[model samples]
Target: MRHARPLPTYLVQRYHGWKATAYHENKAWYRRLAKEGQHPRAMVISCCDSRVHVTSIFGADQGEFFIHRNIANLVPPHKPDGDLHGTSAALEYAVNVLKVAHIVVMGHSNCGGVKGCYDMCSGHAPELEEQASYVGRWMDLLRPGYERTAEIADPAERTRAMERQAVLVSLENLMTFPFVREAVEGEVMTLHGLWNDIGEGDLECYDPAKGDFVRV
Candidate 1:
């Protein structure tokens, strides 16, 4: 508590500006939203990368999407081992409570977390290999992805493939949850995988028919 301080001056100023303009203009909408509660259509699991703006990319308004962000946008395989699980909690809430129709796992280009997984799996990142490194342990989920892309000779292309695998792996892992699986099996829910090219502003979606990501 002693380390806590007031928000930064720039952020305070920006908040005030927003409050005076956007908030002022949308006061009724905000109040209605507060009263009605959220009923988002989809749950989006995306990277912690600052550049990957999920709401902006989808043109989503406030309360339109239930977003859960984590390193590499990963969803670990279901393990009800009586431990803390933030992403799983969110998924449970989104599916059981909110009952979102779609769950989208979105991966993006130049993801540092995916690159770290690649390096760690390749034995190039000793720090991540340590037992105490949280990131390394979490990224172990992507080891299968690294193995899938290891044969590619081009480093850049291999990294790109690894990034896509993040989305694919997460999509696969999502089905491990009984509730999610039941929902999908019952045709009430659908799973999607997306990859974004940040610089080019391009998006690709997984096409089950072709078994590859197609431009969107």
Candidate 2:
């Protein structure tokens, strides 16, 4: 707690502005939401990238979507060893408690985490290969994705493919959890994969039939 600092002046000013405007305008709605509690329709697992705004892309309002962001938006396969698993904990709550109807694993272009994984797996990033690197350990989750996309001749295209593979890998891993599998198999939940082109503002959704991402 001693390490924590007070809110920055600019952020405080921005918060005061929001409290004066948007919050004031929707005071009753906010109060109602507080009273009724949240019942989000979907759980969106997206990257920690600042450019990927899940709410803005879907035009969703407060409490409409449950969102969780991590590096590369990767989800490790189900492990019940009682270890610290933030993503799995979020998924458990979203599926069992919140009963979200859909789970979307969203990845984006120019993802630093994906790039790090690519570099590490390609033996180009020795620093990331160290045991002391937290980022390296986290990026290990995307090793499968890197392996899947390693053969592409074009570097740029290969990177993009790796990004999309992150989404695909997460979607696949989501099913590894028993709750997720039960929900999906019982027809109560659905899984989706998405890749966003940050520069062009284009969103592509994975099409099972086509075995590729189709622009939406």
TM-score of each: 0.98, 0.97
**Candidates' C-alpha lDDT:** 0.94, 0.91
User: Any idea what lDDT model 1 has?
Assistant: 0.94
Best by lDDT: 1
Per-residue lDDT of model 1, residues 154-211, tens digit only: 8778989999999999999999999999999999999999999999999999999999
What residue pairs clash in candidate 2, if any at all? none
Displacement of residue 33 (Cα, Å) in model 2 is: 1.2
Give the per-residue Cα lDDT of candidate 1 at 113. Answer: 94
Deviation from native of the Cα of residue 112 in model 1, angstroms: 0.2
lDDT of 1 at 17: 100
**lDDT of model 1 at position 131:** 89
What RMSD, rounded to one decimal, does every model reach? 0.9, 1.1
Candidate 2 residue spans exceeding 4 A from truth: 82-84
lDDT score, residue 39, model 2?
98
